[model samples]
Target: VVGAGPAGMTAAYYAALKGHAVTVFDMMEKQGGIARYGIPEYRLPKVKLDKELNSVWQLRDTEFKGGKMLGRDFSIDDLFTQGYDAVFLGLGAWRSNELRVPGEDLPGVIEAINYLRMNSEGNPVPVGKGQKVVVIGGGFTTFDCARTSRRLGADVTVVYRRSRKEMGAHYSEVDDAEHEGIRLEFFAAPVRFVEKNGRVGGVEFQRMALGEPDASGRRRPVPVEGSNFVIECDTAIPAIGQVPNLDFFEREQGVRKTKRETVITNGALMTDRPGVFAGGDVQMGARTVIECVAQGKLAAKAIDRYLAGDDMARVAEEIAEEEAVPELIDIVPYKPEEPQVRMPMLPFKERDLSFQLIENGYDKNAAEKEAARCLQCVCPDVGRCHLQRLSLEHGLTDNRFHRAEPVDYHDYEYDFSHDFILRDLNKCINCTQCVRICRDVIGANCYGLMGGGYDSIVTTPWNVSLKYTDCVSCGACAETCPTGALMMRERDLQTYELDIVRCIYCGDCVEVCPHGALGETPNFELSTYGRFGRTVLAKEELAVARTWKPSEEIPLDGHNSPRPPEIRPPGPPRWGD
Candidate 1:
């Protein structure tokens, strides 16, 4: 592995897991490349980063050689000669783009990447403490510099050529910088540096107007005629995008690279040379940390397959299919309104010269509450739901007792009534949270175990509508439900248009209503009335509901709350050993 960024570490991890002898070499002194040096301390602390990187160090037979750069210390052929089986190049995009404007070579004018890197180390750059700094560009790096300057007691201003919406930086970062008294001037592109006495004074900017969409699909910023302006300051920092630095890549090695300097690779991440693979920002230009990690992992797979003599093309196709965009399932889940748990941050008043971390990540309770609010749209409880997690942990992906026929899977209709809860029986994994919470916590005893064997399920007594039971509408059951089985409905009545053709006007719904949702109105008609909710009952549905007679075992103890019968397990698996 080369360049110990997120991608390199991830590749090293996967390679180590496969029992491969791995050695990570980086030009930097530390394991985390950008995550350690590039990002500011206030954003990502050194201790936390070190802790994460230490995991790779714990692996047996894996070695880390800091300051061992490619092309200088050793070449691709050199590694191959050293008995190494495979090489993964995770050289990240480190080299920041130059402004290419006049006076850019001035002393005070700096690149934000270098500034952040210097600050991250004990060595601080001289652009703070009574200095008026104007940062050019609007990206994470730009905000980082502006905010860092603010903390360093610099009167900072961020100038971008497009609207705030068009900025490449996250809105949260931009908002935080603005809140920290960092001025933001939009529709202004850096024209040149306003030199004063040779060193630097301020930056001259050109006012811009948005034009047709560029290749990126965002409106391109066009320079406005005669709209020249200058912001007087002591320093000018350009925090534009970065590109991969291939200074170490020798042409004699035969690895191809794009004009952007990103390494060109096949679908399997292999370069032109055999056994030479590249991934992360070095391959996919400048991307997110997660994307880099993903690239590293995929590259590891390709390397493993290559080593195992598998067809590279077939492996690439399978990987592409696995990583294909997931089909969008248009399933809307109802959830109660709850504000996100806010993470505590360092007070703005105390954010001067101190590199103390800003965000104090969510606590246990805060994390749990925030996690519980997830709609669990995909598998409902992907991260938070213990059932889903445990299923994955136990490797439940391939069930032991596979359904032999199409009739094995149960399909049940949904119940959207009861005002406060939604019941989608299809998603219920039978975790029994609802059964426990309703019976033990709420004491409403609305639900009980019904059916037998593999078909066992929790439902209201006799599978009656939740409103028919003594439900308090406290939403305890929905809250306790692990999956998207029972979700708390949005606090609104679902309007059901009355089909007059299907209405028999039998008034059975009005008679059997528990919440008094149906009753005589001022008009003295059998239409849906009262405040509980308006449910326009179809004559056919009413007929089926009317036929649902009370079982002899059911008792009228406030509700037809029938106690569940003793579960008698029928024998072991019929076919399994």
Candidate 2:
């Protein structure tokens, strides 16, 4: 693993989980690349960051080596020579983009990343109390610069060429920065820095107008003629964007990079070099922390496959198929709507001279309430479902044959009649697995493909309930079901007592037995035979078992008589064995 940022650390952590030895290297003396250095302490405390990063290091066979610059200390070839099977490049984009304007090289014009890194390390830039600072650009890093300067008692102003909606930073970040008294000037682009005695003094700007949408789908910024202005300030910081510094990657390595300086990778995140992979900012440019973490996990999976002697091309194709967005299912579960929980924030007065944390997150009660609102969309048999796996493997998503008329569609009623099994005929693909398993294996012959043409469906005879059939509650049908058309019902185990008296002799009790455990007294022992390798009725309980004549009228007091206990069923080899 290279560059121990969120992506690198995540890859190393996953690799270690696979029982592979992983060594994480970073240029910084500490781990957590930009997460630790480029983010302000108030936003993410160093202590908490260290605690989280330490978890990756604690994994078995995982090692962390800091202060190892890629090109300066060691090259990619050096790693292969060291006997490492695969190398993952999670190097983050750290070099900030240039303003390309005159006087940008002035002393007061600080790099946003550098300023944040220095401040986080306890050495803030020279923006003293009551000084004026102008922040150029609109992004999370731009806001960080403006807000951090505000904490230092500087009169800060943020200039952006785009409107608020097009800004890269979240609305909450902008709102908090405004609440902290930072000024915002939109629809303005900086032209040059105003010199003040050989140091930065102010920035000249040109008013802009939204033009035609660009490749990013945002309106391009067009300079307005005769709309130039100047914002007086003592310092200027531009946080437009960042690109990966590829100086570490030698040209002889055969690793390709885009014009933007991001490494080029295939669908599996593998670079041109067979054994090398790149992800996160280095491959996809700067992205959110969560996105970087996801890429890291994917890279780790690819690396594992590569180490296992899998063909890279086939692995790449599989990854591309897995990453394809599947057409959305129309199943909409009804859930009551609830208002979102509002985050508590520190008062603006408290933020005047301090870099205290904002957004206190959710309290325990609020957290639980928010979590309860989640409509979990995961299927119960998600990982085990063969149909789902095949759907993904074949990319069988969107159904173009969806009929427009409601009469053309068929929706079946779900059958919950069986106590131990749930039958959703709607989910049946007519695979006949349940039919064959029941007839050939269990010999119950409870299911068959019924009807003709498109209306045909696999179901019990006469489309009756499963309990009404000759099912033995063996669960072989559900086990063999590729889709969740048939499934074992989940329930808590409970003790059941069958009264020896009140002998109506209607046989209704035996008829409703979900597991088919209740039957003629002579064959009753067989139902519980393989289930837990025990008998449903103990010797003491069976001694009292007796049949009453139909003419006998039992006393009401006989209702308290002990009966057969509810036994755990469908044991080894199959349910109900």
Candidate 3:
């Protein structure tokens, strides 16, 4: 791994997981590349970022070497000669694109990436208090520059050549910027930077009109003749775009670059060289952190295969197959609509000359409520569906029986009344696997063939809900059904009681859960009898109780005789009656 940004770190982490000795190198003194140096602290805190990067280093056979430039410090051949089998370059686009207009080289004309990097390194540029800052372009970096300047008590104006709809920055960022007293000027292209005493004093722009759609599918900005205008300012920051700095290697290195200055790679993320690979912003240009992480994962898989002496071309084909998106069927699952959870942010009034964190994040209740809105339409047994596997094995296609009259086939209403199980009778083939398993094997006897003749179907007694039957929620019926007529609900519906005695306190469950439902109480140390003698962990018992027993007496044998009743956690209401 050549760059320690999101992509490089992710690649190193996955590569280390494969039992390979991985070494991650970055040009900066720190591990996180752009995420640490280019992005402002308000957006992503350095402490949290460092914690994640440190975990990657903790992985087996992995080490991070900072202040090491790839092409400058060591070449691909150098790595190979040093006993390394393969190399991955997750380099970033640190070079900011410039505006071609004259006077752009003035003293106060700052590059957005350079400014952000400087601020991150604690040597912020002289952009504070009573200065007018003109930010050119409309992207995430552009807004970052504008917002950072705003926080520094400077009057910031974002100048974009295109209209609002074509602006690259997210709408939320733009809205927040506007709320923080930043001005926005659209459909204006920079003509020249106005100089004042050998420094940038203002910017001259020409009015533009939206023309036909360009290759990017957005209407191009066409310059309107003689419509020149000037916006007075003390600083000029052009955040037009970013491109990778490929000066480290020449063309003979077998790693090719495009005209846009991004690295060129095959489907397997390998360069022309057999053992060299590139990914992230170095290959895809400036993109989201998630996209960079995805590419890093792909590069790790390809590098593993390369090191294992597998065919590179075959690996590329396999990667392409895995990446291919499957066509979705035309079935829409029924799901109730819920409003999105609103993020809390610092008030605009308190933002003056302050870089304090914005977007306070969701609380435990809000996060769970938001997560519960997932439709979960994708069947859990999709790839493992017995019916699907059999159909493919026999090369089956359309059902010829569907060509018969509408009365020949039955369409039954789905039964989702059960708390833990979902029943879609329309998908049932009357296989009786559920009936036999329920009656003969598990002995739940919850299902049977109901109705008569053509109307006969496999269901609970008298077509009642599974909950009303002798169903034990053993999941044997769902496991035995070949078709998707029966299935276990994928969501974690029930609130669970943590057995303090059995819990190892690894905190893995708390860390890995997407929804913030589970939380650690402050006094888990009192859970064991070793801390305080007489099994005095009253909180665990009272956690689930409907009424408190102030006068309850302990058995003193440490077992407590009877356990406390299980109670559901507060908020994000449960589904079952």
TM-score leader: 3
By lDDT, is 1 or 2 better? 2
Q: Report the C-alpha lDDT of model 3 over 373-453, residue by residue, as the tens digit.
A: 876644544544545555666888668445378767777788888877899988787878788766754445788998767
Off by over 4 Å in 3: 328-331, 375-577
- What's the true lDDT of residue 84 in model 3? 85
Q: Which RMSD does model 3 reach against the true structure?
A: 11.9
lDDT of each: 0.78, 0.81, 0.80
Residue 226 shift from truth in candidate 1, angstroms = 2.2
Tens-place lDDT per residue, model 1, 256-318, is: 888899998888898888788899999998888889998898888799888988988787776
lDDT-best of 1 and 3: 3
Query: Tens digit of lDDT per residue, candidate 2, span 1-577?
Result: 9899989988987676555789998998899988988888778888889888876765456788989988888888999999999999999999999999999999899999888888877885888789999999999999989999999999999999999999999999999899999999999999999998989989999999999999999999999999999999998999998899997566437798888999999999999998999999899898888899999988988998999999999999877765564644543446877888887888898988787777678877887788777765434444345466676669987764547788978888888989999988878889886786577545578999888777888988988899987787767678667677888886645466756443334344564444445676753432212243333444344334333332456323235653332322222223331
lDDT-based ranking, best first? 2, 3, 1
- CA displacement after TM-score superposition, residue 270 of candidate 1 (Å): 2.0
Provide the TM-score for each candidate, comma-separated. Answer: 0.65, 0.67, 0.68
Q: Is candidate 2 or candidate 3 better by TM-score?
A: 3
Residue 213 Cα positional deviation in candidate 1, in Å, after optimal superposition: 1.6
